[model samples]
Target: KAVICETPLGCFGQTICYDLRFPHLYRKLSQAGAQILVVPAAFTKKTGEAHWHVLNRARAIENGAFVVAPCAVGKVEGGGESYGYSLIINPWGEILADAGSDSGLINANIDLEEVNSARMRIPSLRHDKSFQF
Candidate 1:
């Protein structure tokens, strides 16, 4: 799912958990003018342990957009375990906050200007070229 939110700052895009695995989706959202990406996930313990933080950071760094992932903590209805490392990552791949297995909020003072700064430093988005396999 994609959500385009027009906040006081700029356009923010929201994607569901599984959508985080798709980079192209985030790129499309960025091309359509998304500066921040929010991912709400109930990432499984198994996969999350191996890929959660890295994926979220990679997405933010590569797209030059802030990544805010709010993950579900503790056991679910079906006895499924969720990796609760909810994170707030900056455009530069910096971890602003991490909620590690706790039931609480992780706050970060995000500066929208950093998005532009990161993009300016490495303009990968503008450099993308489509090629056929």
Candidate 2:
């Protein structure tokens, strides 16, 4: 299930690690009026290197919503490493901030109005159609 929280800034939708793989979940959240999607992940270094950035940007682009992903870095308890590179992406899939491989902080100024602008320009969400087979 998808959950959303309404705030003064925007309507945020939450998802944890590994949920990044599923596009339908994001679509559900966006359909429910989510203007921002938050993903807090502890992705393995291997997978994150391969998929993290692209997946985050894809979600934002497809949904016309912002994606804020704060990822875990450094060594894990079990042995492998957690990939860092925390990201703050915009509705147009532009990377606003990226906290490279170390554990630190990164921030960006987000305009909720960009959500409306991006959606207006793309209008893909409004074009969604039911498929019958």
Candidate 3:
């Protein structure tokens, strides 16, 4: 399912941790005018250790949109653990800020112009063509 939110800045979409693995969902959101994507998750230590950062960065790079993923780092109530590494990735797949294992604040100067620049250079969104046999 897709849910697009309108903020004063622009339109944004949000997804859970598991949803980040699906590209089509993000594609649909971006297609529908989502300039930013939020992934708020309490990823398990097992999975979070392996794929958290890469997935977030990949999503930003592939969609040419900002990805703001905040992952819970500590262990949960049910004996589950969280891998803390909240990230703010830019449209160019650069990590603007990262919250490390400990509780800390991350700040970055985000310029929306960069989104336009990346999309202008590689307009993949406009070039997708679907075909089936």
Candidate 4:
């Protein structure tokens, strides 16, 4: 299930690490009027390297919402290392900030208005159709 919280910044959609793989969750959040989707993840280095950026970008592009992903870095307690490439992407799927493989704070100036702008430009959300086979 997807949860949404209203904040001073905008309506934020929350999801944890592995949940990022599911697109339906993001669509639910976006349809519920989320302007920003927040993903706090501790993804394995291998999987992160392969799918992190692309998945995050796809979520932002498809939903016309900003994606704020803060990923863990360094070795985990049990074993393997965590990938640390935190990213702040806009609704247009442009990466505004990246925290490259290190534990540090990354910031980006986000304009909430851009959410509306991107949605207006591509209006895919308004065109959604459901069919069963």
Per-residue lDDT of 56-97 in model 2, one digit per residue for the tens? Answer: 999999999999999999999879999999999999999999
Candidate ordering by lDDT (highest first)? 2, 4, 1, 3
Count of residue pairs whose backbone atoms collide, per candidate? 0, 0, 1, 0
**What are the runs in model 2 whose C-alpha is more than 4 Å off?**
none
Using TM-score as the measure, name the better of candidate 3 and candidate 4. Answer: 4
All models: lDDT?
0.91, 0.96, 0.86, 0.95
What 10-residue stretch in candidate 4 is worst by lDDT?
122-131
Given candidate 1, what's the lDDT at residue 99?
98
Q: Which stretches of candidate 4 lie over 4 Å from their true place?
A: none
- What's the lDDT for residue 14 in model 2? 97
lDDT of 1: 0.91
lDDT of each residue in 1-133, candidate 3, tens digit only: 7999998877788898889999989888888888889899988888888899889999998888999888888868869889888999999999999998876777777777777888888798888678899
Q: What digit string (tens of lDDT, one per residue) describes model 1 on residues 64-87?
A: 999999999889896988999999
